[model samples]
Target: MVEVRHHYATVRGHRVFYREAGAREAPTLVLLHGYPSSSRMFRHLIPALADRFHVIAPDHLGFGNSDVPSVDAFPYTFDSLTDITEALLAQLDVTRYAVYVQDYGAPIGWRLALRTPDAITAVITQNGNAYEDGFVPEFWKPVWAYCENPGPQTEPAVRAALSLDAIRWQYLHGVDRPELVDPDTWAADHHEVSRPGNDLVQLALFRDYASNPPLYPQVHAYFRERQVPLLAVWGAGDEIFGPDGARAFARDLPDAEIHLVPGGGHFLLESHLDTVAGYVRGFLTAAASPA
Candidate 1:
């Protein structure tokens, strides 16, 4: 095992914090975490895959220890996040990497793969949206409503979503094995999201996500046109996005290899770290192995 190194990369004026491990020349596994949380989501999987790959996990701006500039200072759009992610990867000299998409990571990863289709060798999605029919929770309704009619009223919804209890519920709601999730994990997410004006980032991003409905068609087209191999690991129990959404990936990406985790949630990557890592490594290795 290699010693993990924490560092910073200035992107769009945010000192984006990240952890880099594994040899520079090794295959890179780029991790895109969800909103209201940061690279911290990948804590368990990072070490599992580090020995075989260069794992790069960054705290998206306004999330984790990364920047939290005023919502006025930043757009908080998924497109903007995609831009920042691309710039950071290029600046770091990462080439031909596999994207590990989880939660909000799906949208960000979709935009990245669209722009630089060739840069991606494969994609591994764990409980991320690639299909349209997956189960979505009741909590997302208010946020979606606000996205439709964004205004000062949207502020309350954002505040509600970013609330400590709300975030804790999102992280731990569907876990079959509750003990696997440490209270500290949710504590850290709740704390980071509680930062001043941090709630606004959540607001702005979710608002922009309302506009994201159109992008999915484009994303579907890109996957079809590029034939990018995808391995979707879904926790059927996820309250956010359900089994139907997981199967939806198979609709657009007919060949997308799907792994349905019997009991997992938004944090399935954490709960099924070894199984997910094994599936991902196998996909990457087999794809690159000329078979």
Candidate 2:
């Protein structure tokens, strides 16, 4: 069995926590986690892939075990977050690697690829949205409203949904096998997000998320221009990033492999870990084959 090890690196004068497994000589696989979660989300996936790949999963600056600086010191924009993550990867001497992005991880991964084109070997997106068609307004209207007016008046509705109940809902919603869902998943998330000043950090990211959709054109152009290897594995039951978002990848890169996991939800990894792991392992193997 592969052993997962925990370590920390100083990026931009802040301590960032990460999980590492496998030998250094193996191809690197960097896992970027989603909202309300961290490298902790990839705990099982890391060990699953560690036998054949060098897996590294890091918690974004404010999320997970990383140091949560005051908003005054660290601006909570995606750019800033990615900059810190990029610095962390560079500190660890990761020259080339594949990125597995989910939820907020999409923006971070895309930015990493854009910043260092030659560094990214492949892209694996799980329920990570990067298109206009996938940004349905029904679920995002409240988010948009909060973005438009960032204050207490507009925050209650958003706050209500982000409570422990909502965090639990995020994990269990649309999941076919509720028994497979772990209560600790949301419990840990609630503990992290409910930290004294963490709400401000989350809200900042929520507002900054609006900046991502406008860049979809650039992201699409990069996919077409670079002809980068792309694999999209999405949960069909996901409310935020639906099947449409999963299929949109094929439009940009006709050769892109698209898999819509039925009976899976946004937090598919929670319930469908082995299934997604199988897909990832096979995809990486095929991607390494010579044309």
Candidate 3:
């Protein structure tokens, strides 16, 4: 793993943590991880692509070792996080790049696409969603309910979401079996959450996400009409955002390729790094053609 480094953008008033891999001049590939999982998710994927492309993986403000202030102080909304990403890209002078987004990053990354259409040359999504059909996870109901009235049960739930055990469970529970991942990864993520006050920010982000699902239609529209080449690499065993969710990306993207790993979960990168890396490389190569 690359040593932790900070990228401070006066534009956003926060110091973000990121690790840049491969050569600085290789075509850029920005890897945006999901909720609660930091840039660390790209540990394996980064080295694989480092030989050919510049790989950047950043911890979203609340997820990893980046700045996580009180929920009252920061705009933990999906929209604001998208803005942070845009600013980071601009700060880094990345003009055209492929973005790998997953889970909660679906909305934030899509918002970035909407805001900066030309800057994103391609997309790589694994277990991320933008389809009306992909909305059936039972875990989301509480989040939606809390967003409608974020008063009584909000604090406790948010606290729950941030617990070390909670984040660990979210990462591990749905796997076909426990050996799908190295125990050290779980230990590290759990340790990250064990830090005080991290969980509330996580739950707060989820609570705010309740209102942002409406952005899907425009994202799907852009994918279809704009012909962005998307590689939807998903694990067939993801109970949270199941295989059909992977098909949903293909539905919106005519030029999309969907790859399914028979025994993977929300954290497919943990188990299917080789296939994910292969698809990303191939997709980036094919997506560079003039549309």
Say which candidate scores most in TM-score: 2
- In order, what lDDT does every prediction score? 0.81, 0.89, 0.76
lDDT of 3 by residue, 28-92 (tens): 88888886678888888888887878888878887676887778789788888888888888888
Order of the predicted models by TM-score, top scorer first: 2, 1, 3
lDDT of 1 by residue, 212-286 (tens): 557789888988888888898888778888877777787777888998887677787656677787888788787
lDDT of 3: 0.76
40: Cα error in model 1, Å:
1.1
Which stretches of model 3 miss by more than 4 angstroms?
Answer: 1-11, 153-159, 289-291
* Candidate 1 wrongly placed segments (more than 4 Å): 135-137, 151-155
Task: Please write out the lDDT profile of model 2 over residues 1-291, one tens digit for every residue.
Answer: 899999999888999999999998999999999998999999889999999999999999889999999899899999999999899988999999999999999999999988898999889999998887676566788888988897888788777666999888888777888899889999999999999899888888998988898778889989999888889988888887778998999888998988988888898898888889999998888887887
Residue 168 error for model 3, in Å? 2.9
